[model samples]
Target chain A: MTPKISQFLSQKNPSTPCLVVDIDEVELRYRAMQAALPAARIYYAVKANPARPLLDRLVFLGSCFDAASWEEVDLCLSAGARPENISFGNTVKKVSAIKAAYDAGVRLFVFDCVEELEKLARFAPGSRVYCRLLVNNHGAEWPLSRKFGTTPESARTLMLRARELGLDPYGISFHVGSQQLSADAYEVAIAQAGSLLADLAADGLRLRMVNLGGGFPIQYRDDVPGIAHFGQVISRAMKIHFGETLPEILVEPGRFIVGSAGVVSTEVVLVSQRGRDEGPRWVYLDIGRFGGLAETEGEAIRYMIRTARDGEEVSSVALAGPTCDGADILYEKSCYTLPVTLEAGDRVEILATGAYVSTYCSTRFNGFAPLAEHYI
Target chain B: MTPKISQFLSQKNPSTPCLVVDIDEVELRYRAMQAALPAARIYYAVKANPARPLLDRLVFLGSCFDAASWEEVDLCLSAGARPENISFGNTVKKVSAIKAAYDAGVRLFVFDCVEELEKLARFAPGSRVYCRLLVNNHGAEWPLSRKFGTTPESARTLMLRARELGLDPYGISFHVGSQQLSADAYEVAIAQAGSLLADLAADGLRLRMVNLGGGFPIQYRDDVPGIAHFGQVISRAMKIHFGETLPEILVEPGRFIVGSAGVVSTEVVLVSQRGRDEGPRWVYLDIGRFGGLAETEGEAIRYMIRTARDGEEVSSVALAGPTCDGADILYEKSCYTLPVTLEAGDRVEILATGAYVSTYCSTRFNGFAPLAEHYI
Candidate 1:
């Protein structure tokens, strides 16, 4: 947790099962990315944590936004972001949502297949449209399926179609995947994009931008390669692949910007070992899978946890949320260890939960309220 | 879809991505379970789509409730249910919640460990508490972990401890699992609980109840053992184990009571095959895993889907939700087939989605609102 969040939790002691986001930390991460990639325009992914405070900070920093929906476009606009500064980033979108975003003056949008391209052509007429290309998800913790993106061969045809349909064939975009572990993942995608760009140029289609979609990783339970390593790797890859005649660089970083800026503070509701003589103790917290820690699905994203008794005796434990549903478990096979003396009412803080958490909570599953939020 | 729900949808033409629940059908299922298990008490598990209208209708039919949280307890009471008719069924609960339930005159609760039993003894003093036993989740689509129950040996000790600590050692409880398919699953669990009850009696503690916690099946994409089949198997098992001196029989049916009573009405957002010549079509809907079809995680609860063009030629398709997140996919490998003519603006109905769909929705995962609810 950031010092700002630590001080807020210590002083305010907001109710358990709430998130505390350090807004200053968000601005700091934004500047760090800006400084690292000086030429690249950083589009803060609004879907990560679309809180007004976070958006307001980014808006003040003149940060561009990558909105996933019409609602998110409105959120960015409400925070004083310019319409031209936001890109409708989700590949699969409703025609109605496309119309809404267009009517709201948003021009840039992303599409993968011909159907979505057709929707944008008809509803978001004459808009800047980019085709998303499918690439390898080699080292992502939350790897995306073929649910999105088209083949580079298909993307070439689709971008050509976008131009034919009275749309600006703006650029190309592709996601390496969320929480991407390898910088080489982006390298591979960039190479694919470069080859496609070179082929498109021969067909008299010169795209102006290369939208490097968000997949930036942050510190969790394990030590991840810092952002500097990713910046250096991306810069070198761009130089190697697209040399002198460089296109506009656009990077969407969601987790890297806001992930470490927040923490989830929960109370231990119950702890059990199920009467076993030899097994990990089951630790139950007020917040769980349905409660907001959804990235823990399949034990994919492990978050570092802290307690008031952290320096005390410890034992191996399985962690779960407080719900009646069996699927509400957060981490089981991950082998998380906690203080043996941990009991009901003890405060516990899950670190680096700032992004993709507050909004993922169920409205009121099992009659429990959604996780409350505090932006310091 | 039920005739009532189908009629409601055709007449109402509500907004897309909404759940239409037939309250009359809910009453019918409640009464059907009551008729099948005449000697058993039907406690409607409130976690499964606890819309106020659903709860109000069940209350009017004189149905008792199995609440997963203190807020659910209040929901039951607000719906005209008597305090005595509500049982705090979730084993993992907060001490403050226990005190609140006790102060509200709730007398029955469930616990699986010593720490929880002590909390009950202190906060809910003299309340009737049952020990939840861990049973094999064989033949269950959504199998539970060792998260909410104790072994029979541990249960016996906890029950004795309950008696010694000014609390009523009410009985033993075990959940076979959600969407349980095999009739023999209940038989094995009943046998386990029967032996435990016998052991507790040998300690001079006369337990007064046996909660065969709800696992009654409802039809989905695949056929399951009907509620009648589950009721008969449970009745026969209880008879073979306890004979004539049967304790109070309690069954908490959440999904079975409401699963088939609701249908999710959604609109097709986009369809893509990723420019592949031969592959399953990728059909994206207005709702998905985070949009309330969370049971689709691991593709467990497969709900039968119907489209307006159902009679048209069909093609194998992968279903997904309209979100920016990659994990928002509903069914990719489950081999769902849809009308080849299905396109954007086409209405689709996800059947047997009444139980766990509405409340499982993320509040606003990617700027998309939670699944709207329409109870008739």
Candidate 2:
């Protein structure tokens, strides 16, 4: 446990619960992804735990930033990301956020629905925009295909409206749902996106970019494809669908970029027996659903967890938080043996929580503050 | 809508999201429970959203404070609860916390494990200690039995140990579970607690109090029993099982006291249609699982949502939040007919979130700040 956690702890003060970033691992992945897709631009989703150190590293790797809110826009700006390189893709933007992002130099934004497009038309004149297509290509059944993305018909209308308003509609973007495990989903989404772009071009609309919205699968489970392979498949599909003339490609790889770069270190507060005979015992930890790990609810995502001291392996024990609520249990059920009994004051290291975890969760229950983040 | 929200919002800053508390609702429940258990004392669990206004209201209702941590103890003390009226009952006491609570003038505490008792004995001598009994009297299905409550056999040993250390072992307590829906569970737990108290008394240990523990169910779901009837059941069990000759009885009610009195108000950001032909449509709100309402997960609890404004009623639509993650959907599949089209900038009130909502949670994700709180 200690060996696994040594890199995460402050050599001076190791006991404090916090989020540690594996900068080396992050840089290695960044370099690999960059090497694989040298022509494609990578927009680091700033919503995935925007610590300054991580932002700095992404900048060093030539990765742009994807911001959701004005605050995120300001964060990327502070991290020295050029506004021209940042994409404000929250879709549902407040007028103030729109102005702020534009003023902060963000050139590209996403237009999902007509209302959002109208808002953009009224507030952001002459801004480069990406009309999001609902790639209902029967991709991953995930994300339920029902939020921001407008239908291809609606996307056509939005693109025409953008042209009518003299807005620079530079490209089309579509998310095939997050944590999408199917490789065919990308192939189908890319085909749909390619068709939409061709239709818009046929309708006299020119495009210079196509944002294949990021849903590149991260290995939360071994059954999922590896990130490198996912990149290769997507690149190949883009070439196959649109050929060599495909617009300058952009991938908003949020989870794949930072998901494996961070680990949350929490203490085991209590361990209790569950089923006396046939059931597995449970060990209550200091983290739960609110511990920046909302992706597990149905994302088909799982995290690597281990003891934080002495390099011990923990056995299969259900984990729950201190919340009296039953749903506070973290894992469904799994088994592993630890080097030692996780007594009071023992810490557990949860891996791959860097991405959608803390960035999308809150400490709105049990009074546990969000873990302080540190980049290695 | 503005008119309805006016009662729970700041007149100067009306648009900010917030949790609103109705003091009267909390007070009425506290009084109803108090009147039913004439012989039983009341310790309001402050960990269940210890809002200052709520604590002040509970104090006005003549309820003692039950603090689970040093932060809660400090909150109670600062709220003007007399030191003698505060009981520090967290079983796993940090050494510093034990010394701190004792120094803060809290004389009553619950000791569950012998190790904790010994630590408290070494640090806080002559304190009025309560032995927490591991009464697995909850329904057979509730498998989290080994967490708290020292068993009767071990509790007796702990009581003797405390007495040997010159600590006043004045009471016995048992926690059934949180939001316990079963009236029989409380009755059985009380009966078992009575037997334990009687046995301790027979062993020449005088009992000054008996805590029936907090499992007082709140009406989160349609099938949950109302607090008024549940209070009567618990009051009757204590009176019948302990014969009214019991020590100054105590019951800690966390969820029941404030669950109905509070609601989280957030604005609608977007609405999206999910699935096709036969799928559900979702209205995206600004709140989610990490947004102080734990109702989004598998927790049996449900939030009764309504439009903040009174006007035309619209069709029921599924609700989600601003997070890009799939788990950000608020309603699993529940439909809510609102007073208006929940467009951007419209507020929706998520009711029954007062208990174990904000205090147990913090706004740490996505760099979102916790909603400001208000008291009505």
**Which digits, one per residue and each the tens of the lDDT, describe model 2 over residues B1-376?**
1243346454544454577777888887788777766766789988787888888877776789888767678888888888899888766555666788888898998877666677778778899999877666454222334555656777777888899988889888878777677878878877877887788889998778888777776655455776667668877887887785757878888877887777777777665442133444557676665556555555345667666465676666666666554545566455555554557667677777777777534354544566667777
Model 1, residue B228: distance off in Å is 1.8
TM-score of each: 0.99, 0.85
What is the docking quality class of candidate 1?
high
Worst 10 residues of 1 chain A by lDDT: A142-151
Compute the lDDT of residue A349 as modeled in candidate 2: 78
List, residue by residue over B1-376, the lDDT tens digit for candidate 1. 8898989899989998999989888988999999889999989999997899999998888889999999999999988999999999999999888989999999999999998999999999999999999999988999874577888889999999998999999998889899888989889999998888888788898898999888788988887767787778888999999989899999999998898899999999988887999989999999999999999999998989999998889999999999988888899889889999999889999998999888889999899998889888
TM-score of chain A of each: 0.99, 0.90
**Residue-level lDDT tens digits of model 1 in A147-265:** 78889899999989899999999899989999999999999999999999999999999998998888889989998897888889988888888998788999999999999999999
Best by lDDT: 1
Per candidate, native contacts kept equal 0.91, 0.19
Q: For residues A218-324, what per-residue lDDT tens digits would candidate 2 score against the true structure? A: 66535577766777888899898788886898888777777777777877765544213344455666666655665555434567776645465545566656544
